[model samples]
Target: MHESLSFLAATYVGQPIWLWLAFLAFIGLLLWIDLGVVNNKDGVVSAKKSAGMWASFSAIAVAFGAYVYFVYEPDPLYYMSPDNLNQQAVLQYFTGYLLETALAFDNIFVIGMIFTFFAVPREYQHRVLFWGIMGAIVFRAIFISLGAAIVNEFTWVLFIFAAFLIYTGWKMIFGGDHEMDLNKNPVLKFLRKRMNITDTIENHNFFVKKPDPKGSGRLVLFATPLFLALVMVEVVDVIFAVDSVPAIFAVTKDPFIVYTSNIFAILGLRSMYFMLAEAVARFKYLKYGLSMVLVLIGVKIIWNFGLYKGWKDMTGEALVPYLEPQWSLIATLGLIGGSMAYSWIKTRGEQNPA
Candidate 1:
């Protein structure tokens, strides 16, 4: 037992194992307080209540950033200088958090659609989202670990990520049809064929025992619409992560920064969805902002690579200087903020012309 505990305390990936354990404990506590304490009785979440929860979660995330700023010690080899490491780590965390949160707005829209297609009740929606977020946490951790390993081993993989981001962004900007039909979803189709699924929800239960339809006396476990909705939600996140994980990596390669920022953004997703579901349509221009963000980050990645390689033989000395994290953070915030501002103003003007 002593040796096992000692091994668990040892450092991995630049931070002590205890730090990772602490983070996991913190997340587990938040989940408990959310599902078991504050929302012990499941019901419809009012927008007002959701707004308050969103603010509280955002505050916690910001406070966590402060903790990282003050407590984290960046390795001297990876950082530019020890004097600025704390500030840089904090900035990267917030930047990544903001980017992931902004990108997740799209997820909210998709989730809302999924629930609508399934005719999921407002009261039951939160339960699905709660479990969906739990699945997302696990999926994102896997993706982040795999991505970090790939980037660390083959620096050229960053270029591929950059290219993919650019391609996805360009499609978002130019693509006209984003509508999805849940009935046509491959996962749903496959599950329907393989499993005993019921057309109606059975309270909030995902699975329930029911009489088999084939004239058999034995009861069979059947999946409810709620379960299918949960599965769809999980699959939707996986699709979004392909774009978002790369975008965060473009900000910083540190696993701690990457993982914490992604989790923090996702932790508040349920509240965010409740707060914005009805009004998300007003932010029509936000997609343009998101697309631009991806394009800019893609460009930044390529530019950073060029700086290291002397700009493809254009000069003996390196050209296209590498962008500092501070500048990247500023750029990211400006683009997202400006886009949102434009969206709000445009929508408001249309709603009430002066």
Candidate 2:
């Protein structure tokens, strides 16, 4: 009996099996409540309701971060002192969460664009985004697992990730306007060729059986614009993950921390999307903040690597200082908050006029 219990609690990929299962169950419960209770009906979600939902999900994420601080064994392997380990793990989780949430705003922009391009109605948008979130969960899991494995094997990959982040951040700040032209999107073009699609939405159904467009006396499956919107949403997330997954890896290498933070940020994104979609144009400075975050994290990764090598060469003597996870978290929050404040003031001034 003791051996069986011990086996169930055994560590896999640096976390106990039970921990992983608990996290999964918690996420499952949230999804169930979201789809089954809070938003069971097919109706347009008002901005006020979306705001309340965002707050609820955001609070849950913060609580989970607090739970990590209190319950998790920070240094199970005893590498760092207990206090330092606890601080580092908790700080890493929050930093990863904040960074991911900030980066995810870019996704909101893309999602909004996709829905507008498809002319998706407000009520049906939730259904597409809900399914999109489901796909994101699976996709992020695979990305995180693969990323953790690769980084663990090749430590130098961190440098590459850092460099990529720097490049991406610079481009975002200086690049021309990013417009999503559905006509130019290869995925949508391909789908159009491969599937029979309807010209209009069919009451929130992704696919509906209809009389064959070819005038045959049989029913055929036709993909609705809603499904195309969902597919585009999924594809956009995959594209964004190329940057976001690496950005989080720059924060911490712990698969548990990485995965949990990523999932929590993503879990709230659908509600966040609805809440901010109509007001996206108001936050003009948000991209600058997001750009700065990526660049800061990239620099932090490189700085830490330099400190590690310098410490080794100096025979345990400290050389260059490294940016701690806590400081990184502070900087990220400041940048995001400051940018939001600036955006609000500027927009308010413009609205009122001198």
Candidate 3:
């Protein structure tokens, strides 16, 4: 099955450092221009503006998608048959993008809650989300690298990932603890034990350094709650990554497509958070839909494993073969889009009362 899928794992993992650096710089430039130039407005980012930004980024992705399509298909680079060009590449990009975006929807929901928890002003929310997404990019890069390494070395790691997805799905569907207990976090505890934390948040600043006792120095430190919130966000990101990264692997093993799409999806997340924050609460059923997707994908992964191991009889296999990587990608994207659309329509109907 792996051979048949035309896995481009080596091509992606061996992506040049220069290429990676250039990609990072481009994304960073866009982010700076977005926050500094286009969205210099003082008030909340309105729906119209947010929608426009979403469209712009999506258009960029599609243009890149066309380049990828033309480069690989018909034109043919390193492959023999034009059809030999892996469909997994395109599907993987789309699947990884969809999974990352859906996972980010949960992140946005939590960010909204966090903003409410702190009573942060609307104008500052974008700044916070910007920093949060920046942190997420770093953390997720670390996560995807570690995860890809493990999954590459030990195929059984997929089983562990599948189990994790099932457990996470169960929790999401059952509505697990949504409480944000700062005290329970180890980083917060350590900070409380070692340092003095101000009772009030001062102008939403996360860090404040004191003058050094030795005369010519400074001691830098984060505000206690800021540290706590940062820790909380990191924890949430790790949880989401565990489910999302594996979900994409079920689509394709092409790390370039997976990682690139993941980056693009996350790069847009701060803007998405601003746009979705208020409306998220109304889409109560969306979590259930995502949970179901997680469960279904997890089951698919397990079933594929069984098929690979030849656990099923020939007749059983003949009846229903394992899901293909391309089909899996398409299905995952379709499910997420359909679920969001359904939730939006339902929410709209409720608002209209007709």
Candidate 4:
């Protein structure tokens, strides 16, 4: 019993094993409630319900941030006495979570576009988003794990990550308007070429078995457009992770914090999409705001260069960047908030003509 307890208490990826297990288990419970209780039926989630769901999930993330503040051990090794969570730990977690959620605003736009391109109905969209996000949760886990490992081993990679984010941000801010042509998506093409897909979604199912036209006595599993949409969503997730993973790492190298923050932020996207799907593009300037957010996070990483050890863990060291976690959080809120408000006001003016 003691050995078992000790095993759970052992550290993994800069956090105790039990903490990881607890967080993951809690997430599993949330998903079960979503799948089994809250969203058991195939129906369009109302805007009111979607907003409520987003609020609930955001509340949970905030509460968990508090939990992290109270329980997270700065030194997982317990080298120092009472290494309970400090302001910096909580700040980093909040900053990462907020950054990820901000980035997802742009992602929701693409996802909304994907669903539109596939001509998916409101009812069937739920299943696609649920499963696609499930896949995202898994893939992002791998990406975060690999990322944390790489950054921990080679800190110089922070510079590389910063450079990539800044370059991408610049492109986003200056890049001419680009539209997604789903027909040109390589993943979609590959899936289409390989799978015998139906012209339309079938009873909200991703696949349906049909008798092949080849005069065989066997049924072949045919993928539906539903499945194709799910694939596109999954593909989009991988593309976005390249930015979000590094953006989070710019704040902290702890895999546990990164994983938890990223997942929680993603949990809100399904609801956000439901609430804003048909209207996300109306907020024209929001994209620029999110792009600037990426730039802010990137610039935060590059602040003070290597002179202050900016990206290092703040647990025991005083070498944290000059732009501290609190400042990052504040600036992040400002950029996201200001851009959104500005976009809202401008969009309303165009609609109202004064």
Candidate 5:
């Protein structure tokens, strides 16, 4: 296992810096076209157009993934190995991206709840999501940094995080829980009681009008409802990140790959949220599927640690377990794809019975 990790790390570390730069540049160009050119319209993205954007965004990600595989870590030396540098990079990228995107579906559910609670206007929904993503970027950066520091300083931390993942996954799969009860939400209730709130949403404003210092005009900053909802968004994201960050760490300790995969998936989340909100209700079985993934990965992490120590003591040899990474990658992909397929089929079958 150590040798395999060393080889994998070597391939990544030896990749040329220029290749990474080109990849970033391409993503930037795509962002430019998306915000500057395509999103010039004022209203919500229609379903047909949303479908197109999804296709385009996915294509860009896949193309960029291919570019990274070939340019950075092109396999050489007869190129016939079942395992090669390009294949490894692609697998890692897909695994990371899939985890981020799959978990993002949960985010859409919360966003829906937030918007409904605050009564935000349909036209301004994108703005909230845009700013929410910005906040997520900052929050995830802090989380990744803290997580890396802890994992490095204490080797046993992985076991604790793994146990938590397994527990959360099990609860999600078997607990049959949904619909967060407001009475149980202490923070939200506390904020509502403490803050002054307006009865009606004024011109899609988030807060009640307040007097400006200079007496220029009424200021419309974070209103009580908006503030409460944003808080919910941040809190929800933190919970989701707990499962996702550790899963990514299992893939590769390289911060660059982890951070980049997170960035690409998050960049598309605003559009994805709008696209998936109505459809999320149909995916009754998805939570179970995601739970299965979390348990599998958590077991893999614990097993990896145990396997390494077991081999070292028994044979006086450092061995990293074989196919652990590949199994994780394959299982993560299967859970996501299979869940979505099942959800789609169930929804369609119910709509038009056989």
Candidate 6:
């Protein structure tokens, strides 16, 4: 018993193992409540319900940040400490959460496209999204772990991530929105070729046993269009992670911080999708705003990379030092907010054009 307690007390990725365990347990409970109680029936999720879910997840995220600030360590009292680093952690959490949520807003449009391409029914979409999020959770963990390992071992690699973010952000800002041709997606084509896929969704079931078309009267499990949509959604998340995981690392490299903020942001976005699915086109200019957010984070990373390497030692107390987390949070909020407001107004103008 003592050994078990001690083991829980052990630290991993800058946090106690027990903290990680508690978080996973909390997330599990939330998923149960979501799928078992809130959405027990597989009907169309209303925008009002989506808003409520988003609010619940956002509130949970805020509560977790408070927990981090006040109770995670619980040794010297984080906020009152001389250095006040605990407060910094809370800001980083919110910053990372906001950044991730904004970056992933584009996903709603993509998801809508995926569902349309597959002709998935509204009743079945929830199940696909639930399983898709499950896949995302697993894949994001792997990516974060690998990224954490690579960055911790070789600090220079962070700069490469920074460069990648800059280039991607530039593309996002300048590159006009292009329609994705799911028909040409090689992943979809490959899955269709390799898997025993059904022509249509099979009553919300990912896999259904159907009679083998061969003369044998045996039942064979076949993948449904629902499953294909789920896989495509999962694949889209992995692609988004390539951009977001690095961006969050810049916010704060604490894997726990990065992972929790990321998953919660994703959860929030999943719910928000239902709210915005039909109206995603109204906020079209948000693409630039999100892209600029990435660029800003990249610049922050580059500055820190240079500052810590040799500039800090040379400048000593004279330099501005690392980019402050609070300012990053503020800048992120301002950029996103401004973009949202502008997009809404422009969209309204176009719709009401006299």
Tens digit of per-residue lDDT, candidate 1, span 192-254: 999999989999999999998998989999999999999999999999999999999888878
Candidate 6 residue-wise lDDT, 1-354, digit = tens: 887589898877667888888888888888889999999988999899999999999999999899878865532321212366777788888999999899879789889999999999887788788878878888988999898888778877878888988998899878767878988889999988888888877787889998997758999889998888988998899888989999998777778888999989888877988888877888888878888888888888877666543476686542445566898899999999899998888888475322
Ten-residue region with minimum lDDT total, candidate 4: 76-85
Model 1 scores a C-alpha lDDT of 0.87
| lDDT at 5, model 6 | 81
Q: Pick the lDDT winner.
A: 1
Q: Please give, for residues 233-300, the per-residue lDDT of candidate 4 as tens digits.
A: 99889988988998888877768788889999999999988887766756778767778777877787
Tally clashes: model 4: 0
Q: For residues 260-311, what per-residue lDDT tens digits would candidate 5 score against the true structure?
A: 6776787777778777766777776787788888887778766766676557
- Candidate 3 displacement at residue 118 in angstroms: 2.0
lDDT, residue 149, candidate 6: 84
lDDT of model 1 at position 167:
91
| lDDT (Cα, 0-100) at 296 in candidate 4 | 76
Candidate 3: residue 205 lDDT (0-100) = 66
Q: Locate the minimum summed-lDDT window of 10 residues in model 1.
A: 74-83
Estimate candidate 5's alpha-carbon lDDT, on a 0 to 1 scale: 0.69
TM-score of each: 0.94, 0.93, 0.79, 0.91, 0.78, 0.93
After the best TM-score superposition of candidate 5, give how far the Cα of residue 70 lies from its true spot, in angstroms: 3.6
Most TM-score-accurate candidate? 1
TM-score of 6: 0.93
Q: Cα miss at 92, model 4 (Å)?
A: 1.0
- After superposition, which runs of candidate 5 have C-alpha atoms over 4 Å from their true positions? 1-37, 71-89, 182-197, 204-227, 317-321, 349-354
Query: Residue 239's C-alpha lDDT in candidate 3?
Result: 65
Q: Write the per-residue lDDT of candidate 2 for residues 13-96, one digit (tens) a residue.
A: 788888888899999999999999999999998889989998998999899888888888653532222457767888989998
Number of the candidate with higher lDDT, 3 or 6: 6
Q: Is candidate 1 or candidate 3 better by lDDT?
A: 1
Off by over 4 Å in 6: 74-82, 314-318, 349-354
The TM-score between candidate 2 and the true structure equals 0.93
By lDDT rank, best first, the candidates go: 1, 2, 6, 4, 5, 3
